[model samples]
Target: MTKRQRFLQRTRSRLFSKGAPDYILLALVVILVLFGLVMVYDASVIVASETYGDQFRFLKLQTVWVLVGAAAFAFTYLFDYHNYPKLIVPAIVTTIVLLVLVVFAGPLVFGSRRWFSIGVVNIQPSELAKLTFTVYLACWLAKQKQRSGNLKEAFTQHLKTELLPFAFILFTICFLIIVEPDLGTTAVVAFTALAVYFISGTDALHTLGSFFIIAVMGVLGVLAAIISPYRASRVSTFLETIKSGYAPDPWISGYQINQVLIAIGSGGLFGIGFGESRQKFFYLVGNSAFTDTIFAVYAEEFGFVGDVVLVLAFLMFVSRGLRIARNAHDRLGSLLATGITVWIGLQAFLNIAANIALGPLTGIPLPFFSYGGSSMVVVLAGVGILLNVSKSSEKAVFR
Candidate 1:
């Protein structure tokens, strides 16, 4: 059969053979959101109170985002995800336009122009771009894999067919984000897209070559960081603290992380006990701190046990997502699952890693916990599509 015929067959089968959504995944999502709500409130108390004079300001906005996200989740979950590829073009174009517009017209915050403040709502285009780009890739790679015909061609002709288009798309998205100078979000997108490509059944040797390419890109990124005084200071602080167990300025350069580490350590084995955290009132006291180091507040309030449970919960979420990808009946579903999973999983890892000093402080928000409307909505929507894939997996697709 031709590729079109195969694609039609899979779509038809999906429409007719739909199964119930995964309740375990659904239940797990609820638990995480509820826990995150509590933590966001906990972390944002001082910041909200001082900045907005209402301790409930961030929490209320986040609640609205969560509700909006739930609507987004419902939309993706109920729709046939097999049809997502059809909308890829307009979706991606819209995202790119938004990204470009945000660069020129969005409100400037800190040093980067990354958000559009429209009336009472603020929109971050990069978050939407990340999602749209993932859907585009899942469709492209799945179609490319279908057309490759054989393993030899899949290897020999892969670069021309796969990497060229993939590279262009990936570079376009990453370039916009990097120009925003938001390396944290850019890293998440690139790593997630690379993971999706690697998981799409490429050759082992080519995967190694891909790794080498990524290494070169990483080196370039480091060089770029070194050239900027602000970024250089962050790197130096990270390195210095790593080596000498101290921050340059406990209230300025590395001060944020210095406070974060203190929060984590003071938590002891059982945390400072819920709403009794001392760090939020003084050091980690700001709206930015919620996104940058909310995990530290979490660690301080919940202690070691809370940390373990949260990490384990995220691990379970990722494993189940990967399992869905492994069992997806079609290439599109499988690739989509992989991409979405990597997107969520990597952000979670980077956020926590930064908090614990396991990685550079990227200021990336934790998936559900951080107080950002754009991210919360986009991420929950991704989870919705992932659950839709899980629903499809139960119909004669098991290993």
Candidate 2:
């Protein structure tokens, strides 16, 4: 055979020799993104037309974000996953700096300064923090694993060496996020970090101790909430909704949650049919119909059946993520996979629960389905890291 033909043959063999990164997971992600684009247009068309004089304004912006996210996904997927540890320090530092900048310079939107407006694009540092913290924690835990001996030694050493730093970093991030008045993101980041710590093979005693620390933090968080009238009002509103089973007035405090419930109930078994949702027409209040409360608008359009499909897609994504973690080639890969999975899954659950009134309105958007550029980019980048890990594991097993 000619040299060029032989080279081509070898390239094909190398590419196809090992199993590819989980195609099922990739397919599910693509489906969700496509579905999100359609829903974003359906939910935002009227508002876009009225506010911006362009019916496709939000749709067009969301399409651009999806393209940006796709590029991020491709870059991360093709890059080596094992090299992420080198990025841990930079990631942590960048997040801290941006968060501080947000406090001082971020644009105020709806009474909170959680986003930096660069011309037309708004960047939420908290979203970047979530992904950065996950990467940092994964690297930290993996290093902890390598440095320690057995379970008992690991536990003792972690307590002696790692506990203080870990607590400091975790609380710093959480404090910054909460001060942004974004309690939902704070909780998600805290929980994701704790999950990574637990899965890092720490002893049972250390795990329990970690939970005790988290509980103490939780108590402090509750006290902080009670001290703030704005937060306390949210608590009261939630309680009132639970007690009365609906908001007392459509124009009052619990109006958003009530609207969400109306949308869900109106969806019935098969939905109101595509872009036919009446709630998006200034009934749901605010831009939530396209952002945090997008799920309700979705249900209103596609019904209970669509809700089930979306839930199942998330479940499948989580399952595939865990499977990748299980078969990962290294401790870092495993922890990174687990952290990303929990971050996305937990956020999605909190958003859905808030929509259905199972939890207080948290203002947390659904992953991949919400209308935000920063969140879409960060989340898709995380998924790229996960796919890279899966690819590495496949290569490890086959070669």
RMSD of each: 7.1, 3.5
The best candidate by lDDT is 2
For model 2, name the residue pairs that clash: none
Tell me the lDDT of model 2 at 341.
94
**Residue range 156-236, candidate 1, lDDT tens digits:** 687678766777777788777777767788888888888888877666745864775587458647754744457667777
TM-score of 2: 0.91
Query: Model 1 Cα RMSD, Å?
Result: 7.1
Tell how far residue 247 is off in model 2, in angstroms.
Answer: 2.6
- Which sections of candidate 2 miss by over 4 Å? 1-19, 145-156, 223-228, 248-250, 394-399
TM-score top scorer: 2
